[model samples]
Target: MSHPQAKTHRMSEFTESIGTVTFSGIPNEGFLALGMRNYWDGYFAGRAAPLGLAPAEVVHAVFYNFADGEVARHIPWVWGKTTPEEAIAVRERGSAAALRQMIGDLADSSGLARAADLATRAAVSAPIEGRALYAGLRALAVPEEPVARLWHAATLLREHRGDGHNIALAAHGIGGTEAHVLCALAHGMRPEEFGRIHHLPKPQLAAVIDGLRDRGLVNAAGGFTDTGRATRERIETLTDELAAPAYDVLSVAELDELIAGLEPICAAVDAAGD
Candidate 1:
């Protein structure tokens, strides 16, 4: 089932790291414009519409993008003079504006063309499937520009993997709260960062931690115990296994090409940080 070019390496580890960073590092985007545009673009492209109501947008975005509480905490800092609800409302308006804005902004930004090409390279290997995760992402209208096309493709692949991850999380008996807690602990993110960004309650988080300790899944130092590490490993394995179809068509050589192309772009994006 594996692509001949796709050698057996740490595909799961790699995809996890790259996909997580690619999406998670949006805050470090060139500026508000870069950040918002990519956020909105992914928002718009990731789903199919009859776009839901404003409140619905809030619910979906908060669930997927940030911990709702995280949005609440950072609203004053990131968006300024805004509430979490207000921020969601702004995005709900019309993604068209986001698309229009990012297109122009991206044009002026340096090294986008190279990044776009890299995305395209990876995208070529992502085969289509009958599921909405694949179909909806493919449904997005590709822009004429190389950069926009590349961005959309990369977003598509990222979401495709994300859809699979959600399934993997559910199969392991982890709920939203525990899932967030585990991710924070395993990733070495500060509890404050995870709780605020994910909208998790401090008390609930403490309770989860206590429960995890009782199960020998976490330690007093907020790090994973041996069992906890094993659990994390299992979750990652399932996620990557689920995501394998996208890369199944890609040869090891092809995957290597994408990784090579991605390096410079990653550096460029990092350099554009605030």
Candidate 2:
């Protein structure tokens, strides 16, 4: 027999799920989002240098999972020791190599510039000032260079989507600790690592996991139950829903043209894995 508490917990999650999905913008946004995100991820990863970009520079910029830029919590967990002022400098300069690394290969392909120009135009058409994540990124001034503007625009769009994800997770009572825990497990990481990355105390992380288990989302073994996986999937679907207005500036054909333009560049970047 199901416990009364379990049933109550599920009901709460289901209610939040509805509230979360209701906030999604529209359907058109998802069609191009993955490609745009992948493009930025690859381009940025190439910024590594001697005091160069690490995971921490933008971790808090894109996410509120740490409440603020709590770089110490996650940075040392991955990099062990960090140099003084590196984080501050990255925010200022943004790894000077970013433009060179990402733009060189694109020089041979005009599509990259064309797609970026289109995306930059579309990104600005949306009502983004009120969205917290987008607002944070938008507050940063874009450089004069075309590719730099493109990167900033892409980052703005990405953070806009991230804000929606945050909303969905909160609606379901999944705070930073709970969300990170499930995601870490889904990615085959240990619970201790999850705690360090998100700066959760072990007792608190364990408590969140226990709560998820009661709701039938997390297994005792730190893996996802079918319920857990299903919930994560639904939240992501809703995130795209809320992210739709950003793409409303383009017609389906226009978006298709943009995505088509980006495909080869993204594939090449993906293969390089830098």
Candidate 3:
């Protein structure tokens, strides 16, 4: 079932781009109408809904990037307001609606439908061991609508890949907070921006950076050292290898088709600029 000649890296890049863009527009009207307190409420509850009212610790363990106590503050508590199934429904509808609004006619294009079909096959065939989030998503029915199906497939693949990425990070001794610091440095993002996203205080963020520096992964200026860049590269390569099996169901032609079909959608979403 594997195609060694398939362009695995390119496929991973395109899928990651499409998945991240599709997910960014969440907490849309349908989700907000669910009476959640804020964006975080909908985000945590909706994404974790597939896990069916799991504890914050379970979510935090799988999510693997939030600072301490962040997941606990919102989970189970949000479930009190809405059941997991309802949250899943709202998230699907909201994600599909947002994609339609952004891409116009492209959301309904035959090209997208083809891409969805291919992506869904890969997602469903992906290995589920050690991938809690993806397993939950893969258990759901693929939506009949093209846009919704595409979103569902993209998310399933994303979480499948993400779970592998977390495994890679942990194997390298990178904890959640430290991983964010390393990611910020790798992406040329300011450490402050990462802190803001994870709600890490200045002191805590500095501690993470200092630890990376001490380990020689980062310099005093918070940029990656040679060792850091190589480390990050190794982690990414391993992550790609781990995720490659998901797309192994497709041949080179289908992989190329999936990327070509998704490229325009990703471009449009990027151009929309939030």
Candidate 4:
């Protein structure tokens, strides 16, 4: 089925776009690690501030904030740069004090107070289940499989351009096999259209499509199923909720200006082929 051409102002799309640009030029593994790190940092900071915790407390929270399995999955990135012992030492020694200092510094920065206030408001307005839903998606996308990476890549592309077509194009440009490209399109277009777009052989793409269909995530026509739609909507809701508090902190025009300022950088990164 064809979706309307209506415009959405979801924060997830924008954040993902920002994240995509922020990480695009880096190695894929590095980009994934950085994305997870930044996400956790922001997430913990927001969650802790409402509890009246000191900044150091929030930073220290990271050690136990995520499950051990999740930490194990991401620890390789940290370990790659530092010995495991060193990594443990750094976290043990610096997590609290550094996080506290960072928070304090942010509080002292001009306009940062407003941003924090906005973020708090957004969090309060958001659904309690939103975090869990997002966590599931994050886990799915950040896994070791190539399919996982492609999904992550597609998400980044969608955020960057706010268009699935752009995602398909960007995925193809990034050396995604045809199957990967098709999976990206399946989220936003019909199967036949996906087939027409790329001539590359992709036997696995068919299986992926079938799996999504069986799970009711996509329809036979390749449009999002109800579950898929709901997932996307939840993402938008969480982002907007988070960003709303900040909205009052910046004039509408200023936000536009910020995006405008970042556009050139995004363009350069996009042009640099993955």
Q: Point to the candidate with the largest lDDT.
A: 3
TM-score: model 3 vs. ground truth: 0.93
The Cα local distance difference test for each model comes to: 0.51, 0.52, 0.82, 0.35
> Which tens-of-lDDT digit does each residue in 202-223 have in candidate 2?
6766777798899999887768
RMSD of 1: 7.6
lDDT tens digits by residue: candidate 1, 61-100? 4245344353333332333333333333332222223332
- Model 3, 1-274: lDDT tens digits are 5655246666666666556543555544565677888778888888899999799999999899888899998998998789999988888887777777778889878998998899898989989999999999988888999888887888898889899999999999888888777788777897788644546677878888889899999987779999999998899888888988998788878987888888898788667644
Candidate 1 vs. true structure, TM-score:
0.61
Residue-level lDDT tens digits of model 4 in 1-274:
1111221243334334333432222222232343435443333322222223333432233332232243343333433333433332222223222222323433244343333233223223322232322222223213222222222333322322222322333333321232333355546665445543343234545655676667676677777777756644554344343334323444455545434433443343334423
Measured with C-alpha atoms, the lDDT of residue 89 in candidate 2 is 31
**lDDT of candidate 3 at residue 172, scale 0 to 100:** 91
Give each model a TM-score: 0.61, 0.62, 0.93, 0.33
**Worst 10 contiguous positions by lDDT, candidate 3:** 20-29
Off by over 4 Å in 4: 1-18, 21-215, 220-238
How many clashes (backbone N, Cα, C below 3 Å) per candidate? Answer: 11, 4, 0, 2
Q: Over all chains combined, what TM-score does candidate 4 have?
A: 0.33
Whole-structure CA lDDT of model 4: 0.35
What candidate 2 gets wrong by more than 4 Å, as runs, is 1-62, 67-96, 139-142, 193-204
